[model samples]
Target chain A: MNNKKKIMEDLIHGIFLILGLITVGCVFLITVYLIISGVPAIRKIGIINFLFGTKWASTAQDPKYGILPFILTSIYGTAGAIILGVPVGFFTAVYLSKVAPSKMRQIVSFIVNMLAGIPSVVYGLVGMMVLVPGIRKLFNIPDGASLFAAIIVLSIMILPSIISVSMTALDAVPRDYEDASLALGANEIETYFRVSVPAARSGIAAAVVLGVGRAIGEAMAVMMVSGNAAKMPSLFQSVRFLTTAVASEMSYSAGLQRQALFSIALVLFLFIMLINATLNFFMKKGDVH
Target chain B: MKRSLYKGAMKTLMYISVGITCILAFSLIGYVLYRGIPGLSISFLTQKPSYLKGTIGILPDILNTLYVIIASLLIVLPLGVGAAVYLTEYASNKKIVGIIEYAAETLSGIPSIIYGLVGMLFFCQFLGFRTSLIAGALTLVIMNLPTIMRTTEESLKTVPNSYREGAFGLGAGKWRVIRTVVLPGCVDGVVTGCILTVGRIIGESAALLFTAGFAHSVHGFIDGLSSSGSTLTVALYVYAKEQGEFQVAFSIATILLILAFIINLAAVGVSNYYRKKRTV
Candidate 1:
């Protein structure tokens, strides 16, 4: 009976160990697969030309595999989204965290969660039908699907992440910090902005990093509205983002073109890894504070 | 007077900013519902989409979504729950725990598109699954593992140490203690994780597009796993982008919107109920 019980315990322990290691296994699998599949195209095209080339014509008689345009568009799109989303999100978070009555806070926070819950495709559809035409009419551009429309959609899509995260950070600020500032003759608004905001800076930074990650990695919604043209990004001009560049061509692409798409995905993965590192850094700092 | 002016001006700015944010959220939701509801019908939910019939039914897409959710959850729940158990109950080495936690975090942070690419290469190509629903479901299993593990780990932490001590004092083995005392206490977390994972799978589009090729045919669960099909979100993309079928797309969007709404409500209800029970 003792031996049998010991064997059962051993078996259960082994099962739990295997299950625990599955997450590590998955991370290893994804990294290995991406590197193995994403490298050959980079080797053939040469990293500099592939990463820095100014033009992309995968199907042209003499194809050029430049992806500078895609890279820049992704960066610019993410930056634009941050620029547009952060202030609005920051203020709303503050209002929800500190100023709003409990009832109003409950209603507003619910709306924010709903915003987060809406599928990205719905945003794309709305952008496609409403914002695209509106942008064209507003700017007198012949085509409505441009980088600007994509920026708008991305900014809206990222708001929920930013607001929720910043709100948490803001909420976690020790109440005594604000009380101290108020006791020192700082008004309520000044106390929040001066004391609470600075105390929660790391959390707010994490929120921005999260927004940047979301915007940079987004594919379908941007694809629907960005016209998928591999041109240099201009605010009012059609452009293809790094994500859309991969998605638009993967269906029909063959040989080097397909491999090149993998390389683009690798580039995107690297960008996300960078953003994830920054997010982790901020989160650690927030914990320390 | 000057101090009051400063306070008044800052307060006004905060209110304006918050008001604008609320307006944007409400307007988007209202607009999507308004546009989508007009095109929705019972037939749209039940029939198979066909070009020959020139009819737009999303039965296949709806079923595909359900199958993917069920398939992915069936696999993920065990692995995720087991992993959480190990982390909370079995692990002694801090280094191993840190590495495992970091891996989970990295996995969550990686975008779904990368999952689509890697899933295409590893599962579809190497594993010979082809572009089938199983491949997509497997990909989603990876995507959702972190969510389940995190939530489970959280709830496991909440299980009082005294409960574990009581079980051990009674001469119960560690495994028995966990099976009886720890697992039951963490049921709320597992349920929450399931709800969150379901919401994510329903909203997912980019990852599923490649792993599950967009074939719009209705099949039984088993057949659907082997074959290719589109979920509602992917179907929305194809119809809107490829087929120029905006009406069908809007109707699908409306259905998805309703699904999201219900999922959010369920999540709130579950957490509230559990919290109340715990307080009592």
Candidate 2:
């Protein structure tokens, strides 16, 4: 009986060992598959030129995978989102923790959480219906769907992530800090900026990082509003980013084109990993400070 | 005073920023309610999705969505909770614990598209499960694991040490102590985590697109694993993109928004209640 029990214990342990191994295996498999697919494509289109070129003619008999323009568009779109989202998110965190009534805070915070849970496709639908029409009518842009549209959509999409994380951070600030600031004759705004926010700096920074993750990962909404044009993205000119580039072509793409699409997925995966790790490092270091 | 003027400008900007965040979120909700609220009928909730345009019944998609969520939770919750327990209750070494925590957090932050790519290659190719509900649910399980682990860990941390001590004093084994004492005490936390995970799953799109197969069909409970089904989110995506059918997408959006909003509101409330109870 004891021997049988011991064997059962070993079997259960082995199950866990395999499960853990599979998680690690999946990550490695993705990296390897992506590299094999991407490297060959990069060689076909000279790595230097492909990485730096502006034109993206994906349909030529001998096509070019010059992703520099798309890469640049992604970088700046994320930058636009972060710049638009973080300050507002930070202040909302301030207002919720500092100024808002309890009822108002509860309602607003719930709204933010719901916003975070909203599927990207829903954002895409609404953006097309409301924001696109509004942009076309008010701005007199020939195409309502443009890089600017992508930026605005991404900014809104990332808000729930930014606000919730920052709110948690701000809530971490002890009331003692606010009391101390008040004792120093500083007004509420002064105290919030100088004392409370700084005290919650690490949390706020984490919020920004989370925001970056959300904005970077967003696909469906941006694809809808980004015009699907593969030219280099100018502020108002429409262009395709990496995600749309993949989604737009996936259903029909086959052979080398499909491989190249996976290559885009590879590059996208690496880009997000870099952003997350950089933020993680910042958060860790800030905590240490 | 110049300082007073500076302060006034800052206040105005701060308020505006807060207002902007509110409006960004509210506009989506308001738009959905304004359009969808009037069209929502009991019949709309009771029938299946159709390729036939103009009729707005989402019964099949709603049932499919619920099937996927419940199925995924059944797979993930036990596994996630067990892993959390092992890390928290059994593991003694700080190094191992830290490694587990770090891995879970990093995995949580990975983009769902990456998961889509992996699901396509690993599940569809290696496992021989074509895009179906099972595949999607398994992928979602991976997606929600870190959430459950992190949240359950939070709740476990809040559980007083005395409960475990008391159980052990009665000669209860480790598993028994956890089953009887720790698990019961942490029920609210687990519920909160479950709610949040449900919210995440309900809203997910890209990952499902790869694994759940885009072909639309209604599947019975056990057969649900084999058939292709569209969740409400994907239904909205298809309508918005390929068909350029905006109104249907908005109506779908309205349904998703209300579902997500209700769940989220509940999660926040239960989490707050538990948190307050623990403090006392």
Candidate 3:
């Protein structure tokens, strides 16, 4: 009976250990699969032309599989969103974490959670109808769907992440730091900006990186608002992102077209991995402080 | 004078920022509800679309969404909770813990569209699941694993060491201590994780688009798993984008919005209840 009990315990431990390792297994599986499938097309297309080519006419009789347009558009769009979203999110985080009364903070935080919970598709729908048309009328453009509209929608989508993450970081700032700043003759506003914000800088940096990840990885919303044209990115032009590039062509694509889409996905995966490393670095630094 | 000016400008900027956020949130919710609610009706929820009848419905989509949610949660809950339990209760090596935690973070950071692509490659083509609800559910199981593990691990940390020590002192085996004391204690975390997972599953579309092709035929759970179907979000995308049926899309969006609202509320309520229970 004692031997049976010990064996059962050992078996259960083995099972739990397997379960614990499943996430690692999954990451390995994805990386291997992406590389296996994504490498062939790149080998055929040549790395420089595939990554740096400025045109993407995959379906034409003579296809040009240049993805420079998508790459530049993704970079420009994410940068624009960060520029538009971070300050508002930062100020809002400061307000919520340090300035707002408790009840007000609770209400606002709930609203922020609601914002986060809203589906990306719904945001796409709203942007397509409202922001797209508004842009057209305001800017007197021929078409409403442009990189600018995508940037606006992305900025809104990333706000919840930036605000919530920054709030957590700001809230984690030691109360003693703020008290000392106040004791040294700093006012409340100055103390929060100088002391609390600086103390939570790493965390805030992580939050920004998180926002960057979300914006760059986004597909459906950006696809809808950004006009899905394979053009070099200008603020007012219809442009494609690396994400939308993969999504828009996947349905009816065949042969090299389909393989190239997989290659685009491979590029996106690499970008996300880079961002994830940066986020981890910031978070680790935050923990150290 | 300069200090006062700086203070006033900073305070003003903060208020303006708060104002912008609130306006964005209210307008989004208000606009979705305003446009979506007017198109919702009993038949729209109860029936599926018929090309012959010149009518549209989302009954099949609703059922598909339910099926995907149930299947993904059923598979993911065990894997996630088990992993969390091992990390918290069993793992002695800090390096292993760090690796697993890093993997979980990487998983969460990955975008859903890539999951869609990989899921298509792995489950649909490689594994021969085809474009079906089961494949989508499996893909989502991967997507939500980190969320469940993180929440469960957090609550497991709150389960005091003394409870486990006391159970061990009673001559209970390791598994028995966990089964009796640890698992039961983290019900709130599991519940919160479930709610969040449901919300994510509901919101998910890009990942499911290819892994589960957008077909609207209704079937029982067993059949549904193997057949192609669109969840509510995918159906919304199809209607709005492919079909130009904004009215139908709006109605589905309303249902999704209401569902999202409830899930968010439930998450907050469950966490608050657990926090109070622990204190008391």
Candidate 4:
């Protein structure tokens, strides 16, 4: 009876151990799968031609599989979104964390959560209907579904992440520091912007990095509003992102075309991994301060 | 005079940012509802789209979403909760714990589109699950595992070490103590995790698109898992982007919006209830 009980405990412990390892297993699985499927196309096209050549006619008679356009578009779009979104989100975070009354803060936090919860497809649908047309009318563009429309939608989509994360960081600023700032004759706004902001800078940096990850990884909404054209990115021109480059062609792509899509996904995966590393670095720094 | 001007400018900017945030939120919610609510009807909610009859319905997409959520939740709960339990209660080595936690963080950071490609490659092709709802659910299980694990681990941390001590003093084993004491205390975490996972599954489009191809046929749970279908998000994408069916897309978006609101409320309610219980 005693031996049987010991054996049962051992079995359960082993089961739990396996469960704990499953997450690691999944990470390993995804990395391996992406590399395996993503390598063949690169080998065929040559890495330089694949990554730098500007033209992308995957289905043409003489396929030119340069993805510089997608890469540039992704970089430009994410930068535009950060430029447009960070200031608003940062100011909102300051207001909520340092200035707003508790009740008002609670309400705003709920709104932020709601904004985060709204489906990406819904964002896309609304962008397609409103922002696309609005851009066309505002700028006298032939088509509203340009990189500009995508940037606007992405900026809105990333706001919740930027606000909530920065708010948490701001709230974590030591109360005694703020008290010290006040004692030194600094106004509330001055203390918050100068003292509290610097103290929470690492956390805010992490928030911006997080937003970058979200913006770059986004596919469907960008696909809908960015017009899915393989053009070098211009603010007012239709362009395809790295994500949409993979998504737009995956369905009907065959042979090298399909392989190229996988390669695009692989490139995207590398970008995400790089962002994740930076985010981790900032997050760890935030923890220290 | 310069200092006062600087302060006033900073204050004005802060308030304007808050105003912009609120305006964006209210306008989004209001517009989706305003455009979508009028398009919803009884038959529209109950029947499938029929080309011959020239009528459209999202009953299939709704049912598909339900099936995928239920399936994914059933699979993810055990794995996530068990992982959390192990990390909290059973693990003795700090290195293993760190590695597991790091892996979970990495999983959470991965894009859903990558999950789609992998799900398509592994489950749909390699495992021969094909482009089916089950494949999609499995992919979601991976996507949401980190969420459930983190929430459960957090709540497990709150399940006082004294409870375990007391159970052990009564001559109970480790597994026994965990089954009775640890698991029961993390109910709020599991509930919150489930609600969040449900919201994610509902909102998920990029991951489900390829793993579960865009089919609108309705089926029973078991059959549905084996067959290809589109969730509501995917359906909305197809209708609006591919078919020029704006009305149907808006309707689906509104439904998704309402579901998202309810899930947010449920998450808050559960956490609040647990907090009160702990306090009392």
Candidate 5:
């Protein structure tokens, strides 16, 4: 009986070890695969031009790979989203963290979690149906789906994440700062921006970086709205993101062309790695308490 | 008076944004309910997606999704728990565990779309799996592994050391104590992780795009494995794009969202039950 038990325990232990190794191995293989396929494409495209060029076309013969245009659209969309989303989201966090009555805060907090739970594709669906038409009729953009649409949808999608994190950060601010400022006779808004905001700057910065990461890697939602144009992005004009570039074309694309699409994936992976790492670093740095 | 006016303006902006957010949620739900419910007669979910497009139903797509989740969970759940057991129970070195923890965290940050690319190269073309349900299922297992491992680890850690010591007093082996005591205590947590894993897989699109192709409907276990299957989310996207039939897209979106919302509530319900059980 003891011998049988011993065998079972050994089997379980081996199982645990194997599972751990597979998790490690998957991450290891993905990095290796990205680098292996990416290096040659990077060499061919040249680092500087690939980052700076504006058009992407890969065909039977010659291929042109310039990600600058897509990179530009990603930046502009993220920036626009931040501009639109941050003030609202940050204030919403403030409402939840500091200002709202307890009942309201509890309800709002749950709602925020629900929003966070929503799939990004649903966000894209709402954007297409509601935001797209609103932009067209309200703003009168020629195309309903544009960088503008992507920005609006991305901002909303990112809001719950930003608010949830920023709220925690704000909550972490020593209560003494608010109490002291109020004791010295400052208004709520005044104390918040002057004292509380400064204290939570690092945390808020982390939130913004997270939002940027969300924007850059956002594919399906943005893909549905961004119009997938390979050209330079205008707010009203359509654009393509590096993440969407491959997903949009992967179906029909073949040959070296397929390899070229994989190359696009390589570029996107590297870009996300840089952003995601920086976000992690800042999040850790913000962990003062 | 001016200050009051300013306050009013700010209140308006606040209400508008919140209202819009609410409307966005409701509008999608409303549209989907309006179109899909009317369309989801028994016939719709029972038959294959007709290439005839507008008249196609998602019976096979639904079944394939169920198959993918079942297969993927079977592969992921035990392995995931084991990894968690080792990390939380066996490993004492904080630094070594920290590396794996951080790697898992970073992996979660990588977009699902990138996971699709890796799956394409590793599972589909390289391994010669072709675009099948298994291909998508395996990819999702990878996509969800980190989350499951982390959640399970947290659950295991929540099991008090007193239980282990009690078993030790009885001359039970370490592994026996873990299997008998800790595993039962952490069952709810493991279940939460699995439920969440299902949520992630069910709603995922980009990862499934290449691995699972975009057929409106496919049926049969063998056909689902060998043929094209589009998930609820992908179907929403396809209908929203090519069809522009907002009614159909809305209906599908409603189904996906409500399904997600329900599963989430189920996870929370489980967590609450566990919390209560633990207190007792």
Candidate 6:
């Protein structure tokens, strides 16, 4: 009986150990798979032409595979989203964390969480139906689905991450920091801006990084609203994103076109890894403080 | 006078920001429901689309969504819970724990599109699962693993060390102690994690778009898992973007919205109950 019990315990231990390593195994598989599949196209296309070539016509008699347009559109779109989203999110976080009454805070926070819970495709649908047409009429552009529309949609999509994260960071600020600032005769607003914001800077930075990640990774929303044209990004011009480049063509792409799509996904993976590193740095810095 | 002016300007800016945020959320919810509810019907819920009859329904998509959820959850909950158990109760080395945690974080940070690409390559091509609901569920299993692991790990941490000691004091084996004490204690976390994972799986589109090919047909759960089909989100995308069927898309969106609201409420309810129980 003792031996049987001991063996059973060992079997359970082994099963749990395998389960624990499953996450590591998954990460390893993704990395290995991406690298294996993503490298062949990069090798064939020449890295410079692949990364910096200005035109993309995969189906033409003589196809050109330059993805600079997709790269630039992604960067500019994410930047526009950050520029528009951060201030609103930052001030709202400050208000929610410091100034709002509890009942008001609860209601507002619930709304924000629901906003987070809303599916991205719905955002895309609304953007397509509303924002695209609004921008077309407002700017009197011939086409509604332009890079500008994508930027606006992405900015809204990223708001929840910025607000919730910044709220947590601001809420964690030592109350004494604000009390000290206020005791120096600074106003409540001044105390929050000067004392609380600076105290929670690392967390806020992490929030910004998280928002950037979300905006950059967002595919379906941008794909739906951004007219799927591979052009150099201008505010009023239709553009393709790295994500959309992969998604739009994967269904019908063949041979080198398909391989190049994998390369685009690899490039996207690298960008996300870079963002994750920066986020980790900020998160660790916040923990230390 | 200068400081008073500064304070007034700052407060005004903050209020405007809050107002904009609220307006954005309310308008989104209000607009989706307004456009969606009028189109929702019993036929929409129960019948499959029929081009021959000039009618459209999302019964297949709904069933597909349910299949994917059930399939993914049945697989993920065990693996996630087991991993969390090992991390919290069994893992002795801090280095191993750090590595496992970092892997989970990295997995969470990966974008869904890349998961789609990799899942297509790995599961569909390599494993020969092909483009099917099982493949999609497996992809989502990876995507949701980090969430479940984190939540379960957190609750396991809350299970007091003394309880484990008491189990051991009663002459229980390690597995016996965990079965009796630790697993039962973290039921709240598992429930919360399950809810959150369901929300994510429901919201997921890009990842499923490729791994699960966008064919809308109702099948039994076992059959559905083996065949290619569109989940609700993917169907929404197909109807809205590819087919240009706004009414169908809106109706699906409304159903998804209702599901998301319920999931969020349940999450909050579970957490609140856990908090109240803890304090007591």
Question: For each of the candidates, what fraction of the native contacts does it recover?
Answer: 0.78, 0.43, 0.84, 0.82, 0.40, 0.78
RMSD of each: 1.2, 2.5, 0.8, 1.0, 3.4, 1.2
Q: What DockQ results for candidate 5?
A: 0.45
**Candidate 5 per-residue C-alpha lDDT over B1-280 given as tens digits, one digit per residue, 9 for 90 to 100:** 7645655565565556555555654565565566557655666667765656647666766787787888789888887888888887776778767777777776787888888888878888899988877888888988898978988888888888998999989999878888799888777778889888888888788898888777755466766776667777777788788777676676666667678778867876887788888789
The residue-level lDDT of candidate 3 at B231 comes to 98
Report lDDT per candidate.
0.92, 0.78, 0.95, 0.95, 0.78, 0.94
lDDT of 4 by residue, A139-184 (tens): 9999999999999999999999999999999999999999999999
Q: What is the interface RMSD of candidate 2, in Å?
A: 2.3
Kindly state the number of residue pairs that clash in model 3.
0
lDDT of 6 at B64: 94
Candidate 6 colliding pairs: none
lDDT (C-alpha) at residue B15 in model 4: 93
Model 6, CA-based lDDT: 0.94
The TM-score values for the models, in the order shown, are 0.98, 0.93, 0.99, 0.99, 0.89, 0.98
For residues B18-63, could you state the per-residue lDDT of candidate 2 as single tens digits?
A: 7887787787789877876766778777876565764656777786
Give the interface-residue alpha carbon RMSD of model 4.
0.8
Q: Residue pairs in steric clash, candidate 4?
A: none
Locate the minimum summed-lDDT window of 10 residues in model 4 chain B: B266-275
TM-score result, candidate 2: 0.93
Q: lDDT per residue, candidate 2, A10-67, as tens digits? A: 6655554444433344455666766876677667667677778777777788677777
lDDT tens readout by residue for model 3, A89-158 = 9999999999999999999999999989999999999999899999999999999999999999999999
Clash count list over all predictions: 0, 0, 0, 0, 2, 0
Per-residue lDDT of model 6, residues B99-174, tens digit only: 8998999999999999998889989999999999999999999999999999999999999999999999999999
Residue A23, candidate 3: Cα error in Å is: 0.2
